[model samples]
Target: MDISKLKEMPYDELRVLYKQHLHSLNISKATINTASVDTFYLWRKDSKTLFWDTVLSNDFESEARSRLLKTLSEHSSGNVNALVSGYLSHLRKFRLYISSDSTWEQSETNQVKTEKNTNLRRTKKDIVIPSPTVEQVEFYLTKWDGLENYHLQEDALNKLFLELCPNNTDILDILLKASTLNDFYSTNIFSIYPVAKHIRSLNIDTRLDAGDVTLVRDIQHVTISNKKRSFYSFATKYCSHHNPLDYPIYDSYVDEVLRYFRNRDNFSDFQNDELKDYVRFKDILIDFRGFYGLGTYNLKQIDQYVWQLGKDYFPKNYGKKKRGDK
Candidate 1:
C-alpha cells in the first residue's frame, strides 16, 4: 500500500485500505489473541506497514497519544472514538508498551542523574589539589640541578662509616644515606654515635628491604633529639634516591600533592595502613603514574615536580618562604 496516498485519503477510505492489508496478512482479532504480544509486534514490524511502524516507534505514551490524536483530528475531523474502534484497535496494546517503556526509561534516567549530582556535590566539597603540567615538571627539574650533588655527601658518610665500623659497612651506609638526605631542617645534625649504636642493635638489614613498617619502627626506636616526624622523610628519600623507579618519596609535600591529585583525578582516599605499607603505597603510585601516562618519568623526577608545585601553591602547608617571610 502507498503510505503517502493513505495519508491523503479520507478517514473511511484509509480505514478500508488498512482492513484490506490486515485481511491479506490473515491477521484477525482471533489470530492476534493466539499470538503472544511480542510475536505480534515482531510480525507487525516485519510487515513493513507504515501505520504499525509509526505507532510502534513512538515509545513514549504521551508522544504516541499526541501523534494518534493529531492524525485523528486532521484526517477524521476529531472522531477519536470512531477511529480507535475501526482502524486503531491494535494501538491499545501498543499504548501499554509505550507507557511501560517510558516509565522504565524515566526511572533509569533519574537514577543516573541522581548519582551524577551526588558525585558532583561530594567533589565540590573536596579541596582540589593542583597537579603539575608538563611545562611545570620541566621547570622544576631545571631547578633541581642547583642543589648540591647528594652523591658527594653519601660518599663522605660511607667513608666515615667505614672508618668508624669496618664490619657493618652495608647497614651503616643505609642509615647514614637516609639521614643525610632528609629535607627537614634542624639545628642539631644527626649524630653518628647514636645512629651507629642503634644500627648495631638491629638484627635485620636497616635498608628498605626490611619493609617500610619495620624500617620505620626501627628508626623510631633509635631516633633521638626529637626527629620522629622526619623518619618517613628520611627513609623515603633514601629508598627513592637509590631506586627511583621502584620507590616514591612520602614527605609532607608529597602527601599534599598526592591528596590534590586524588581529588583532581577522583581516586579513592588512601587508607592510613595502606599509606604506611611501602609495597602497597608503591603499587598505588605505579597505578597512578600509569593512569596519567607518567611511566617515562622516574619517581624522583615526579617527586621534584610535586614538591615544587606544593611549595608554589601551598606555601604555608610546605613551609615555603612567603612573600614577607625571611
Candidate 2:
C-alpha cells in the first residue's frame, strides 16, 4: 500500500481507497461521508509526507500499519456505527497541524477552537443558571430575612447552644433534639452521643478548622452501630452554628448551586468530592464571590443566596406535582 500513489489519485479514487482499507480492516459499519473524504483527499495532497512521517515514526511495523489503517477510516455523519469518525477527525486536525507547524501539540488558534467546542459540549444540555449579580444576591438576602419560620428556628437553636450548652456539657441533649429539627436523620439516634463526645473533645469553643470538621464528620465508625456513615453535612451545620463565618453549611441545596455556578460561570475549578473538604469548599466559595463581584457579601450570605437559587431551580424532589406546578 504505497500511499505516495494516493497523492496523485483523484478525489473519487481516494474515497474508494479509504473505503477499501476500512473494509479490509473489517470496519464497514459506517457510511463514510463526503466531507471527511474531501478532507482526507486534501490532507493527502498537501501533506502526505508529513502524514506518513507521523504514521511510520512508530517503532513497530505493526504499530505503523495500524496507525495508517486508522488514518484511512472516513468520518461519519448521523449514527457512528464504527470507530471511524475519530480517525477521520484526527486526519482533519492534520490540516491544521501542518498549516501552523506548531511546536505545541495544538496551535494557539486550534487550542481556542478546541476549548470553545469543549465548553459548548459541556453546556449543551445545561440550563444556564444565571450568575449572581449584586442585585440578585441582595434580593435573595432580603428574601432570607423575610422567612420568619427559618429565623425563628435558627434563633432558638442559637440561643439554646450559646446559653445552655456554652461549654457543650449538655451537647448530647442539644443534639438529640436539634437533629430532628435540623434534619440530621442520616446520623443515627445512638450515634448522637458519640458525635457530641467527639465535638466536645475537639473543644472547638473558640475556633474550628478543616481537620476539626473532618474529625466530627468521621465519628461514624466509632458509633455504637459501628456502621460506615459520614455526617459531612451535619458536621458543617454544627460547626457553623458555633462559628457561622468560619464554617459554611454543606446542605444539598448549597452543594447543587455551587456546582451549577461553577459549571456555568467557571468561577472555580474543583472536583465534586473536593467540596466535601472544608478548606477547599470555603476557598471555592470565596472564588465564587470574587468571580461574581459579590465580595461585599459574606460566606453566610452567599450560602443563603445559592441555597435558595438551587432550591428554586434544581429541586431534587420528584414527588407528585400540584395542579399548576411546572
Candidate 3:
C-alpha cells in the first residue's frame, strides 16, 4: 500500500505485494494472472508490450481506474493524493527497469518511462467512480422510463398475461408465451405444462409468500434424457412477473451486482449462496436500498436500477455465457 516502499522491496517481494494488493481490490485471479505480475515479473520489465499493451491498455478502462481510486481513497490513511503519488512512483520504477546494451539506450528508456509514468500519475489522480447519489438514481430511472424496445416487449407480455393469465385458471398457453418472450430456455418444453399446473394448484394470485417461491422452484423435478432439471431462476421470474412488488427476480446479472456491492460496501451480512434463496435475496435488496438511502424507490424500481447497473458495470461474456450462469 505504501507505494514509496515499492522501490526498496525485493523483486519477488514486490510481486507478492502487488498480487496481494490486486486481490485486496477484488480483481479476479484470471486478471491478476493475465497481468503476469508474478508469472513474468511484469514490474521488472520496461517494455510497453508487456502488461501495458496487453492488459491495462485494452480492457476495463474505467473499471481499473475507478477501483484503484476507490481502494486508495478508502485506505486508513485517507490521503488519496499521497497514496496515488506513491502508486505513480511505483509504475515509474516499472517502466525504468529496461536492460540495454548501451548507456544511451538506457537513458532513453528512463526518459520515456519518466514521461509515461508522469502522465499515468496525472490520470490515476483523476480517476473515481462518482459516489452514488439520489440525483444519479433519478437520472437512471429517467433513462429507464425513456426506453423503447425492451419496455415495449415487456408491456406487450404484461398485456397478454393480463388478458390470458389473470388468475391462472388455465395458464399453460400464457406461460409458454411468457417463457419465449423472457428467454426462459432452461425450462423444458414439456415441463411447462406441469409447472403451470403446479402454479395453478398453489393459486398464488395477488400475494406471494417466501414458501410459495421456494415451493415453485423445488416442485419441478422433471427429467428429460435422464437429466434432472429444476427451473429455479425461471420460477422466480415467473412469480415476479405475476407479482413484482412481492417477488424480486433472480438472475446472474442481479446476483453479480449484489455480490459486487456487498463486497464493496458491506451493505448486508449474507453469503453468496443466500442470494439463491428468494426470501434472503429480497431481504438483501431491501438492505441495499436502506444502506444507500434509496428508500423512496419500491422493490421494482430497485430491481430496475440494480439490473441496469449490473448490465453496465459487470457485463457478461455474451459469446461464452448464458442466462443463469454465475
The number of the candidate with the highest TM-score is 3
TM-score of 1: 0.43
lDDT tens string, model 1, 1-326?
A: 23344345654454444444333332333333322222223223333354445555646345444555555454432224323222233554444433443322346667566456544542222222222334445767787665455335435544543444334346565455445443222212346456545655664344544344445445434566765423444445434444444456665555555666665553446764575555666666665555555566777677667665555544452333311111
What is every candidate's alpha-carbon RMSD to the true fold?
Answer: 23.6, 17.7, 13.0
Model 2 C-alpha lDDT per residue in residues 1-326, reported as the tens digit of each score: 23455456665676564554333222113222322353353245346554445533535344433454444333221112122333344453433433443322446787666556544542213233433667568777898789886767668767765555545445675565446434422332444665666655655554443325454354322344566556666666666666667666776667777887666546688999998776778888888877766777788888878877766655554752211111
> How high is the lDDT of residue 266 in model 3?
70
Best-to-worst TM-score order: 3, 2, 1
- lDDT-wise, the better of 1 and 3 is 3
Off by over 4 Å in 1: 1-135, 146-193, 203-230, 241-245, 317-326
> Residue-wise lDDT of candidate 3 within 1-326, one digit each (tens)?
23334445566675665565334333334444433342332334333234343233344344334434564554423334323333343343333332222212336666666556544533212222222336546766887788775577557656655556556556676466545634533433444655555566666663453435555454334445567766667766666666677667677878877786565557787998998777778889988877766787888888877776655555554553333333
Task: Please give the range of 10 consecutive residues that has the lowest summed lDDT in model 1.
Answer: 317-326
TM-score, per-candidate, Cα-based:
0.43, 0.53, 0.55
Who is ahead in TM-score, 1 or 2? 2
Off by over 4 Å in 2: 1-126, 171-191, 209-222, 318-326
